[model samples]
Target: MKRAYVLVTADKMSIRKAAWQCGVPIQTLRDRLERGVNQARPLGGDPLLSRSEEEGLVKHIEYLAKCGYPLTRKDVINLATETAIFLKKRPQNAGNLSKRWFVRFMSRWPELRLAKAQKLSMKRAKATSDETVQSYFQELDRILTKYDIKNKPHLIYNVDETGFQMEHTPSKVVGPRGLKLNAITSERGPTTTLLACGNAVGTCLPPYFVFKGARYDARLMAGAVPGSKCSMSKSGWSNGNIFKHFLEEHFIPFLPQRKPDDHVLLLYDGHTSHISIPLIELAKEHKIILFVLPPHTSHVLQPLDVGLFKPLKTFQNACGARMRESPGEVITRYDVCNLASKSFLKAFTPINFINSFRKTGIFPFNPQEIDQTMFEPAKNLARNHWQTEGEEESVEKGNMEKLNQFFSSRLPTPKEPKSHPKKRKVSYRPGGVAITEETIILKIRKVYADGDDAHIHPDNSLGEVSGEGRKRANVTQEESDSDDETDDVCCVCNKFSPDGLNKLNYLKIVDWAQCDLCNHWVHLEFCDRRNVNDIRSGPYRCIHCVSLEE
Candidate 1:
C-alpha cells in the first residue's frame, strides 16, 4: 500500500493503476492520498493513551522498579485510570482499567514482563549501596596488602553463624490432582546455631554447635563429626562469651599452621556478640586481623552467605524431612547435630568454598565482581540529600490530594481531616570500618570502664543508645523537666509560645490552651483554634490526643 501511494504521488502511474499493480484497493489508495502518508493511522480505533503518554508511563514504571518499588498489575491499572481522569480523557465515574487493557498493555511493551520479586528488608536494601560495598573492598584490600597475604588464599578466612530450625519447610511432591498432600514435620523445635569458618583455599574448620539450655549437654554431640565443638547458650544463639570460647578452643586449635610473623585475615559481620575486649585481645595476640563487613551487608559481601549457607540449609531441610518419616518420632536438639553434620559434609566442599570467596570478590580482591543492579535499590536512599524542601512538600501535598480524592469518591465524607503520614527517619552510618587493635581496643576498654554503659549495643557494639532510643530519652527528659520557665512549652512543636517568647507576660498575651486529658499546654494554632474565643467555644484537644482518639 505504501508503494502504491508513493508510485501515485510520484506520478509514475494513475491511482487505479497503482492500486491494481500493488494489489491495494482503490478506495484505500484514495484515502491514503487524501490523508497523506505521514497522517496514516492504525487499523484499530484510537488508543486510550497517546504514544508519548504510554512511553512516559513506561519510563515511570522502570524508574520505580530501579528504586526498589515495583508496581503490581493492579497498581499499573489504577495509575492509568487516574492519569486518564486527570487528562479529562475518561469520565470521573469510570472505574480503573480492565484486565483486558492490562493484557494489551503488556503485549504492547516488549520490555516489560511479569516477575516474582524477592523479599529484601528495607535495612538491607539501603545498606547494600555501591559506596558501602566499595568501602568494604577498599578496607579488605588495604588489610591484604598490609599483611602481604593477597596471594595467600589459605590465610584469608570468613566466619559466620547461621541458625537451623527443627521444623523444615516441605518441598514439592507429585500427587493426584485436586487431592490435598500433607508432609509430616515437627510441630515446633528450638533453633540450633552453627558457627562455620572457611578459607578462600577451600579449607573449613570443624563446625561448632550452640544449643539452648541452662548447661552444656553431652547427648547433644551425638552423631556429630569428629573434632566438632558443642556448647549451650540461653537462647541457642552465640554471645560474647560463647564466641570467645569458640575462638580460644576450636578455631585457633584447628587453624592451619602458619609462620610466626604471618598475619591471618578474619572476615565476619559486626554483630555485638562478635566484638568484645577479650575477643579483640585474642585476635591481637594471635596476629590475626579482625575485619568487620559493613552493617547489614553480609548478604552481599560475606563469602559464606554469598555461596555456602543457602545450600547447607537446603540439605539440612532434606535430612530433616527424611527423619520425619519415622513413626511417632519427634526431632529434638540431639537429632539436629546429626542432621547438621550430614549437611555440613556435603555443602562445605572445596569447590563451594572457593566459589564463595570468588563470588564475594574476597580472595581474588576484585571489587567489580558485585553486580551494579544490586545497588539500584539504594540509589533513592542516597538521593535524599539531593531533594529540596520545596520538592518534598510538593510531593507530599500531591499524594495527600490524590488520596483524599479517591476516598471522597467512594466513601462518605470524613468528620475530621486525615493527618499526613509521618515520615520515617532513616539513620545513616559510615560505609565500612576496619577493626584493628589500636582502632577498637581503647574504645572497648572505655566502654568497659563505664560500668553503667558496659552492655554491648548490637547496631554499633559501642554500648551507646540507638537513634530511636536517643529520641525516646530526649522526650522523657523534656517531659520530666520541673523548671517553671520550661513548663509552658507547646507539646506538639516544643516551643514556648506561638511568638517564640518564653516570658510569663508573653504567655498570657498569646492564646494558649491546655489539653483536658494530658494537661499539656499547646498554642491555639496547634489546637486548631483561631483565638481565645475559639477555645472557649469547646474543649481544646491537642494533636496527640486527637490522633489517639481517632
Candidate 2:
C-alpha cells in the first residue's frame, strides 16, 4: 500500500497503473487518500456497540469468569441490552438482542472462548475476600521487596502438595440410548501424595511421593519420575517430619549456591505439617525464608495450586488411560513413577510456573488482581424465581420463606426419643424400643398444643445432654445435696477437680486447656503432659489425635 501511494503521487503514475503494479484495487487506493475518512475499512453493517464498548463488555465478562461466575447465553444477551441502554440507545431493539446479534458479538471477540465452567466451593470463594487477599499481597510484597525476589526468580519458590486418586474416572463412550449400569474395568487403588516445589523461572525441584504403608517398596520407586523421592506414611499424607526431610534432603541440596548475605524465599501453606519448628529452623539454617500463605486462600494464592497441579493430575490420568489401552497391562504403584515423570515433565513447564506466579500477583506484586466479586456468590445466595410456562415471576411468600430458611437459617431441631425413668443404656439401633407409651402421649399433647409452629431451641437443656446432666447420676448422695459449687470437670482425666492450685491467685494467671478437635475443656496440667513441646498460640489439639493423623 505504501509503494502504491509513492507510485501514484511521487512517481506521478495513473491510479490504474499503481493498482496494477502494487496488486491493489484502484478504489482502495483512492480511499487511502480521501479526506476525513478513517483509513481502516469499516466493519460490515452498523454494530449496536462501538469497538471500544464491545471490548469493555468482553473485559467485564472475563472478570466475571475469573471470579467463577459463569455467564449463560441469556446472560450475554442481557449484558449487551444493558450496555446499549447505558449508551442511551433506543430500548426497542436493544431490549431484546436477537440470535444474529449474539453470533456477531462472539465473532468480534476472538479471545472470548466458551468453555465449561469450573465449580468453586462457596466456602473457598468467601475465603478469597478482597480484604484478605489484599492483606496477604501487601505482606508478600513487603518480603519480596526486602529480598529483591523479582530480580532473582530462581530464588523465589513455591512448595505445595497434592494427592491423586489411583483410579481414573471413566470417560464418555458410545452406547445405546437408555443404557445403564455400564460395567467398566478399572485400576482402583489407594491415593498417593506428591510434594512439588517450583520457582518463578519454571524450574521445579524433584518431587517427593508419600504412600500409605509401613515400609517402602523398591519396585514402586523403580520407574518413578526422574529425581523423584518416595517415602511411606500411615495415611499417605505429608507431615512435619516428611516436609522437614524433603527440605533437608531434596530441596536445600538443589538450591543454587549463594553468598552468606543472600537468602532465598520459599512460599508454602500454613498447614501444621509445613509450620513445624524443626522445618522452620532447618530453613533458616539453609538461608531459606519460609513465607506461609493465608489459610484457605491457597486456591488463588499458591502458584502450584493455581497452575501446575491440575494439568499434572490430568496428564497422570491420561498416562493411566494409555496403559489401560494396552492389552494385559495393569497399572500399579511401580508404574506411577515412570508415568508421573512423563506427566510432570509435560505439565511442569517453566512458562506455567512463571505465568502462575504472575497470575497470582506474587512475582510482580499486584495486590488488586482479585476484586470484590470473588466473594459475591457467598455474600448473597441465589434468588429464587418461579417460572410458569414461558414467563418468569417473583417467588411466592411461602416459597421464598422455604428457600431462605433452607439456605440461611438453622434447621428445626428433632424431638428426642423418650427413655425409661430408671438409668439404663438406650438402644437407638433399628427395631429397638426406645420410645415408650407414656412418652408417646406426651409427644402427642405437645404437638397438638403448638400445632405447625412447634419449635424448640437446638441448645435447650431438654433437647441436648449437658455436661451437668450426664454426671448427675455419678455425683455422691451427700455432694448432690450440697449447695457449694463444684469444680469444673477435666475433659482428659474425667475428674471433677483441677489437678494443681497455686494459692496465690493474684500473682498467677490460670489458663484452662481447650481441645481444638473436640472443643472440650481440660485441666492445663493434663494438656501440658499430653503436648510437651507446645509453642503454638492458637488452637492446640491433644497429642494422641494429632500424632495419629501425622
Candidate 3:
C-alpha cells in the first residue's frame, strides 16, 4: 500500500499506472489517493480501552508491583473491569475482564511477567533498609578492627536458636494424579528449642537442646551428639539464664585455645532472651564480644538465619518422616533430640558454616555483598503512595484519578479509632554493641539507677516483668477484667450509655438492643429503628447476624 501511494504522489504517476506498477488493486489505490490518508484502520472491532488507557493501566500494575503489592490475575481483571466502568466504556453489569484479555495484556507489555512473591512481614520489610544494614556493618567493622579479628575467621562466631516440633511438616511425594495423598505425622507435640553456634572458619560447637519440663531429664539427650548439652525450660524455649549457661558451659569449653586477651566476636539477634546483665557480664569477663544484629533484620543479616536454619529444618522434617514409618509410633521429646541432632550434623557442615557467613557479608567484611534489590520492599515505607514519575506520569495520572475517585466515594467510612492499652516501655539499645567491661559497668549502673531488676535477675523471664517492676501477668488479668465490665458497649460505634441516654445529647435517649444470636449490644439508631419502641417490639438481630442466617 505504501509503494502504491508513493508511486502516485511522489512519482506524479496516474492512479491506474501506480496500481498496475505496484501490483495493487485499482479501487484501493483510487480510494487511498482520494482520501490522502497514510495508515489504514486496524482490521478488527475497536478495543475496549484506548491505547493511552491501556498504557495507564500497565503503569499502575508496575507501580503496585514495585511497591511490594503486586497484583494477582484476578486482581488485574477486577481492576480492568472497574476502570472500564469508571471510563463509561463498559456497563456496570459487564463482568470481570476474561483471562484471555490478561494474556493479551501481558503480550502487549513485554516487561511484565507472572511471578510467585515471597512472604515477608511488614516489619521485616520496613526494617531491612540500606540505612539499618549499613549502620550494622559500620558497627561490625569497628568491632572487627578494634579486636584485630578481621583476618581471624575462627574468632568470628554466630549463635542462634531454632525450634523443632515432634510433629513433622510433610514433604512432597510421588502419587497418582487427581487423588488425595496423605502423610502420617504425630497428632500433637511439644516444641523443643535447639541452640547452635558456628564460626566463619567452618567450625561448629555441639548442639544444645532445651526441653519443656521443670526437671532436666537424661533420657531426652538420647542419640544426641557426643558433647551436646541439654537443659529444661518451662516453655521449651531459651531464656536469659539458659543462654548465659550455654555460653559459659558449652560455648567456652568448645572454643580452641587462644590468648586470654584475644577477643571472640559472638554475633546474634537482639532477642530479649539473648541479652541480660549476667550475659553481658559473662562476655566482659571472658574476652568475648557480644554483637547484636539490628531488630527484624536477622532474616537477611544473621548467618544462621540466611543459610543454615532452613536446611536444618528441612533435614529434621525428613528424619521425622522416617521415624513415623514405624506402626503406631508417636514421636516424644526424646525423639526430638535424635531427629534434631541428625539434621544438625547434616546442616552444620564446615562448607555450610563458611557459606552462611559469606552470604551474610560478615566473614569477609564486605558490606557490598548484599543485593540492593532485597531492600526494594522497604522503599515503600518512606513514601505515602505509589507515584508514577518520568515518562509514565502524564499517561497514568488521568486514569488513576478517575479510578481513585470511583472507589473512594463508594467505600464505607472508616471506623472511629479505638484506644489501645498502654504498651510497656522498653529501654532502647544500639545494635551491634561490643559488650566490654566499660559497657557492662555502665549497664549495671543504669539498671540500678532505673530500678530495672528484670535484667539483673536472670530467673525472672522478660515475659514475667512488666518493665515497671510490676508482674505482667497480674496487669494483663486486671485489663481483661476491666474489658469484661464494658460488655454493654455499642458494637457499631463503640459508644457506651449507662442510663440509656446519649452522652452527646441527654434528652435524646439512645436505647441499646442486644442481638439475639451474637448477644452483642447495638444502638437503636444503628439498627434502622427510629424509636426505642421499635427495638423493644421485637427481638433484634445485627446485620452480621442476619447475613449469617441467610
Which one is best on TM-score? Answer: 3
Estimate the lDDT of model 3: 0.70
Instruction: Flag the better candidate by TM-score, 1 or 3.
Output: 3
Candidate 3 ranges with C-alpha deviation above 4 Å: 1-59, 83-92, 100-117, 173-179, 259-261, 388-425, 428-430, 455-457, 460-550
Q: Please identify model 1 stretches exceeding 4 Å from their true place.
A: 1-55, 80-113, 173-182, 382-431, 457-550
TM-score of candidate 1 on Cα atoms, chains taken together: 0.63
Which pairs, if any, clash in model 2?
A: 202-350, 223-338, 224-337
Candidates in order, TM-scores: namely 0.63, 0.53, 0.66
Per-residue lDDT of 443-499 in model 1, one digit per residue for the tens?
Answer: 666666764222242212111111221121111100111111222345655433333
Q: What is the alpha-carbon RMSD of candidate 1 to the true structure?
A: 15.5
**Which lDDT values do the candidates have, in the order given?**
0.68, 0.59, 0.70
| Candidate number with greatest lDDT | 3
lDDT of 2 by residue, 66-138 (tens): 5466678788887678667656664755357887888888887888876777556554665566666767777
Query: For residues 216-269, could you state the per-residue lDDT of candidate 3 as single tens digits?
Result: 778899999989998887656666788889999999998888886788889887
Candidates sorted by TM-score, best first: 3, 1, 2
Q: Evaluate residue 332 in candidate 3 and report its C-alpha lDDT on the 0 to 100 scale.
A: 76
Better of 1 and 2 by lDDT: 1
